[model samples]
Target chain A: DTAVSQTPKYLVTQMGNDKSIKCEQNLGHDTMYWYKQDSKKFLKIMFSYNNKELIINETVPNRFSPKSPDKAHLNLHINSLELGDSAVYFCASSQGSGRVYEQFFGPGTRLTVL
Target chain B: QQQVKQSPQSLIVQKGGISIINCAYENTAFDYFPWYQQFPGKGPALLIAIRPDVSEKKEGRFTISFNKSAKQFSLHIMDSQPGDSATYFCAASYLEDDYKLSFGAGTTVTVRA
Candidate 1:
């Protein structure tokens, strides 16, 4: 059984186009997160939601928005994507928003902005 | 700026050898540290974790040695097999930070048989 799942594993779109990536978790976790990994494999947290409330929003641009419909779902929508946005986006979830909890990651979505 | 720093962008170890990866952090508030393993085209999986209170933690063939005074930690893999070849990442976080992890630049370990 897949614990964490993401839709559209591979995405290729032209610059300035909008796109959305969906995520769902079967682990019954309450906290979900969005991470961006650059070509150099540097992973950084983009957004974090706990129980549908935005908890952490890093210095990411406003073009990236994350929405959590429920405890099991978190989606990322990017508006006016640019060439610099080409990278892998990963979705993760944890039982609680605590340091003790282990975050389970889903297969990443590779986005290529042409 | 990257909160966590890792060394040796890549390493190669022969079968049945030990593989070591090191990491350092400047934030003393970080209380949780974890190591993740990622294979090609796959998401990272938690391999092991450690807390600042403990100096060392060992589980099976994996071990984490932490030095709070030096603000550094290391992961050791015993008898590494070819299957162990993957990218390893070190991360640190504090509870008040809402469990937001600061990851290190990954280390790609190549285990040769």
Candidate 2:
């Protein structure tokens, strides 16, 4: 069984279009995260949620928003996407936040903004 | 100052040789260090980890050497095969929070047969 899974593995959209990526984890973890990996392969954390409570919000733009309906799912939504939004989006989960931080990452969703 | 720094953005090693990746951190609060291996088109998986109290930890062909005073650590892969080629990431975290790990820029290792 896949521990962490993300949907819309590949997405191609034009600028100004909005998109959403769904993520789910079966690891029985309580914390979920959203990260963006640029073309240079630099992974940066965007948002983190613990038990559906928003915890960490990095210096990301307001265009990107993360929503966690429960402990097992965290979804990413982008509003009025731009060309700079082209990159792979990853979903991750962990048992807790902060110091208990061993995260399980998903396969990643590749987004190409034209 | 929770930054984890990794060196040698890329490495090329011959099969049967040893591949090493190094990392450094500035956070003294960090107590756990873990190495993750990622293959093409796949998410990273845990490879090996070490705590500050231990100087070294070895599991199978993978070993982690840690220096508590220097706040440095490394991942050494012995008898590396082509199949072992992948992007390796080094991460550090404190036990105080729920274990939020801070990762360094990945090191891509290529083992040629």
Candidate 3:
């Protein structure tokens, strides 16, 4: 069974287009996160939601919006995509926030903006 | 914008040998340090983690060495196998914003059989 999963495994779109990626978790996790991995393999957190409430919102652009319909799902929507937005977007879930919790990652959605 | 810095962008080790990857951070506020392993086309998986209060933590063949004074931490994979070949990322998170992980640039590890 898949603990965490993301849709649109690979997305190729032109600049100025809008797209959305969906994520879900079956691990009964309370916290979900969105991270971006750049071409240099540097992973950074973009946003986090806990129990359908927004928590951690990093220095990400306003064009990126994260929505959590429930504790089981977190969806990311990007507006007016740019060439720099071409990277792998990962969805992760954890039981909670703390040192005791281990985050589980889903197979990333590779978004390529041309 | 990256807080944690990892070294040896890539390394090749032989089977039965040890694979070491090191990371350093300037922010001492980072209390929790964790190591993750990611294979191509797959999301990263947590291998092990350590807190600054301790010097080292080991699990199975993976060991995390933490040097709080020097602001450095390293991951050692003992008895390295070809299956261990993948990209390794060292991440740090603080208590206040514990859920947000600041990951370092990943290191590619290739273990030869």
* Candidate number with greatest lDDT: 1
Across all models, the iRMS values in order are: 1.1, 2.1, 1.5
TM-score ranking, high to low: 1, 3, 2
True contacts kept of 2: 0.60
Error of 1 at A13 (Å): 0.4
User: What docking tier does model 3 reach?
Assistant: medium
lDDT of 1 by residue, B1-113 (tens): 99999987999999999999999999999999999999999889999999999999999999999999999999999999999999999999998787689999999999999
Backbone clash total for model 3 is: 0
TM-score, cand. 1 vs. native = 0.98
Residue-level lDDT tens digits of model 1 in A26-46? 998999999999999999999
- Looking at candidate 2, what TM-score does chain B attain? 0.96
Q: Every model's DockQ, to 2 decimals?
A: 0.85, 0.60, 0.77
Residue B33 CA displacement from its true place in model 3, Å? 0.7
Model 1: lDDT to the true structure: 0.95
Q: Which runs in model 3 stand beyond 4 Å of their true positions?
A: none
Output the better candidate (1/3) by TM-score.
Answer: 1
What 10-residue stretch in candidate 3 chain B is worst by lDDT? B93-102
State the TM-score, rounded to 2 decimals, of chain A in model 3.
0.97
**DockQ versus reference, model 3:** 0.77
Compare candidates 1 and 2 on DockQ and give the better one: 1
Q: Pick the candidate with the highest DockQ.
A: 1
Tens-place lDDT digits, model 2, residues B1-113: 43999988999999999999999988898888999898989877888888888999999999999998888999999999999999999988776644666888999999999
